[model samples]
Target: MFKMADNYSSSKENKEEIDKNLKGNEKKKFEINKYLPYILIILVLVVVIVLFANLSSELNGISNKLNSLSSAKPTTSVTPNSTTENSTILSDPSYNITGSLIVPPKSLPNDPVITANASFGSRLTNINQPLNKSELALFNNANDSYFEEAGQMILNGTFGGYVFGSTVGSNAEVKILDNPFVVNGKPSVIYFGSTTCIFCGENRWAMALALGKFGNFSELYKGYSSFGDHDIPTIYWAPAHYNQSAEDLGNFYSSKYINFISIEDDLPITGGFQLNPMSTIGARINATNNSVYINAFKFILQLNNFQGTPYTIWGKYNVLGADDADFGFKSEPSGNPSIEYKTHNMVFDNISHPNSEFGYLEYAGADLYIAMTCASINNTAPICSLPVIPKLESYEGYN
Candidate 1:
């Protein structure tokens, strides 16, 4: 009886142990199965989120670019404040030039009219007709301050037009077009010059006088240079000396020299090129080498970009180097302190400027790495003015 009881107990114990082992294995299997679905779902969601994020970022980038391109202006010659907006009147696709149709000054007085007698006249030959009498009178005679403000604005950008002429020369060869006085209608132009350049700055009136014997004349006058290395307090290149800023170069230039025309802005410039060439004026107007100046802004566009008041671009030809007595300089110093520095060269003589280089070359090829829009140099108001350039029939030049 005892042995049978013991066997029964042992059998019961074995059965309980087996049951526990089976239970533990079943629990582990259940845990793995439960986690499988969640793991897979989470991986898929992460992939989807990454892809969506990339797509959304790309779309936003494209949208921003589209917005920027939509609004911008170019530098072109548009009719200043003309009602071209209200009316669908495009500019004269075809044009002609009469006494009134004449464009603003482009030539030195002697070579004023781009006629057969002038060297640059051929450039105009391609034009079908003479300039249209698109004359617009400027404001009442303004003051020196007003002219400075206005002229600076012009140098920075464009203003209105003038009934004048200018020489057609490559600014790349020389900085200035020519001493308007040097070849005034190819006349007595004994000498002419300016102060800063020791070459051309103060000679405008003198050259005009020499050429005045012929029909030569000039809208030219002296104020200062457009650029410099440093701005001493009383120096022309310094802001303290002249009220010039990046936004007023063009206005300042026009106020002092060109016909006192006010440049207009605040109009829609749709389809205007960001940096087109037409917007750049010619040698006589200043927009000529602007593109190049724009290009050279990195180096020469500093204080030296344009010289201003009392400081002008001078000219002298009878002698060279005001300090040298022989060529016109001094014995102790480089030259005597006189108005005879660098000799002026004629327009035709420019080809071989190996010895004497002009300011125009640097002006033309300078760096103007400005971005597309809002790239204007002058855009100020309450503009200043100077004496109206004594607009004669044309700019002084040699025949």
Candidate 2:
């Protein structure tokens, strides 16, 4: 009986201990459930804060990039085989000359208008005159060094700070055509400009430099743009009488590889604009007239792209306007030829060195023309093999 009571007491004690442990576990689980919503809420708030911070940082980074691009200068660099969007409109009124006589014809005339005088009545006062011998000597002697440096720059793919194929503000770039304008089984480079045009005055420097690479200028004459048109000092490829006559249709460039034909107006700016004369070659292009190099004039007039003075056709490529703007010397006071005269002399003196301001800018502009010429001629020139020439050609959409 004693043994049976002892066993009962022990069993009763074990059951009480088991019940206490179960109640403790139930109370702990209830406490955890009560705090579970608060824990989830805290975790969601933390995740939201982290996501907002990351989004804010990304937005700030994007904003900074936008600001940087908006404040940057106009770029004069281009990668090869890339097409840049041109923001400028071709028909912008700012590009139009107020009284330009070189207008697009309704139809190309079969023959040139034959005038008895060819001097455009009494408007033409002076005729072709040679430049001073002393002045000509300076340019002739400096040709060798200038050519060497210009070629070097083109080969290097950069001139001054500008890339070989890039263009500056509002300046027209070279456009490729389907066929080249050829003369006597040779490619022809034609230029039509006026002595009174300020852009023409500035562009001649670069044109002369680029042409020098392909040919030789046996004779160049001293000329001034016009008194009303800033009277910029310029060089004429042919003997020309400034502000006087346009009857002299002679050129001095001799190139066996390519023919250079220049048709320029001798008349300068009168009454703040050039005089209107229908008889001069600048005023009208006669298609069938072989005497005045009418083929080039007719080609330009037929194209809807022809705008104004300083027009050039480089092989199959056409540059409708000045390749570049004024090279810092164009700001001289009107009627003051001496300032521009000195500036031209300085450029001539430093033509061989790219360190000078005028020299660098002129050479950069020349490289652009040179690249266009190379593209048109199928890279026949020795300098065309340079890396920059191909890059420039590719950039301008050449084959």
Candidate 3:
């Protein structure tokens, strides 16, 4: 009986030991389940850090490009001032006597009407129009700033590419022959028009701007068209500098590239600004090569029959007006008489308005200048070789 009781006690001790081991295993499983969320969170944090690092690099690249662009833009605006330094006046006697001054007998300060002496009167001419310093300052302050801007835009070829065709102005009807009329061994740009001509008044702005690119103009003076016409404020040929001395022609022409000859055929003769006969003004239009600035005018008439005023002959192309539409068409404003006249007169007055906002026509003028300069046979000036040029596959010459 005692032996049986001892065996029972040992079996009870073995059962208790098995229960303790099972509880310890349950505790180990609970600890592993509790740590699972923390391990997942650490992995997520590592992924977020890598993504943010990549985003930062991309943002930095964009910032660098923006900085480069900011550096390239122009920071200041240019304002044109009419100082003696802006225009170079030659002191040498050789450059002084470009030509004899052509003045109207009535316009000149004289007691009686004077006719040109036979020796002095001809197609080759320049006008001696005296300028009032204060009056000129008013005009210069109104226009010179815009003129400078227009010239730069033409040189840059950024005048909005108004036309892809090589022709300049609306009335490019005539084609110059390839014979290439030369004066003083260089190309000549001949202009035939009148100070009373409103179209010529408007065109002079662009002409001066364009030519100013290649050569300097010293004696250019400000004036206006006839009140009987549109009366637009413009530069008149009266005070323009030209080379008439055959002896000094070669030297002057060599540096200027093209010799510019202009005729202010009619002046404001009466208080009403009536047209009167000026010396050779008629002969100039019908003139042939007479050793005067080459036969550029004759060449123009030869290629295309005489059309009208403001005839510009260059290279092998001739431009009838300043733009394709011919802003200044008639001696007087045309179309819708009531509305057009008022509008036209307003534009004319606005040209000399003290406000800088006026003179949009300068843009058209710049475009014309750019086209003419590109077509010039003697376009060896630095401006002609610019990338902005050569935009025309075929310009005023040849085809």
Model 2: what TM-score?
A: 0.56
Task: In angstroms, give how far residue 55 of model 2 lies from its true place.
Answer: 40
Candidate 3 CA-lDDT value:
0.44
Per-residue lDDT tens digits for candidate 3, residues 1-399, read: 778888887777877888778887788888878998998898799889987988766764565345334433332211122133223322110111122212222133321222232221111111334334443333333344454454445445554442222443332334333334454545556676665555665666656555655565434444545555544445654432221100101111113566665544554412223333422444543443233432333344334333455666654445554442234334444531121233323543544452322344453364455455456654576656544345432443223
Best by TM-score: 2
For all candidates in order, the CA lDDT equals: 0.23, 0.57, 0.44
Native-vs-model 1 lDDT? 0.23
TM-scores for the candidates: 0.19, 0.56, 0.47
Positional deviation of 38 in candidate 1, in angstroms?
76
Better of 2 and 3 by lDDT: 2
Off by over 4 Å in 2: 1-172, 245-248, 269-288, 329-344
lDDT of model 1 at residue 256? 19
Which ten residues in a row are the worst by lDDT in model 2?
A: 92-101
User: For model 2, what is the error of residue 80's alpha carbon versus the real structure, in angstroms, after optimal superposition?
Assistant: 39
TM-score-superior candidate, 1 or 2: 2
The residue ranges of model 1 lying beyond 4 angstroms of the native Cα positions read 1-74, 84-171, 175-202, 209-327, 330-332, 338-399
Q: Write the per-residue lDDT of candidate 2 for residues 1-399, one digit (tens) a residue.
A: 888899988888988988988988999998999999998999999999998988766765565445334424242221223377334322211111011122122211331222232221122222223445554555443344454454455456544434323332223255455556666556778787877777787788778777777776666755556656665556767655443445334467766667787777656434243633534564444642453265455556444455577788787777867765544544645534333444344555665454654665566566667778887777787656655556656654555
Clashing pairs in 2: none
Off by over 4 Å in 3: 1-107, 110-176, 239-255, 267-290, 293-297, 324-360, 392-399
Better of 1 and 3 by TM-score: 3
Question: What does candidate 1's lDDT look like per residue over 212-324, in tens digits?
Answer: 21121222221221123110000011011112111112111222112111111111111111111223312222443332222212111111212212111112111111101
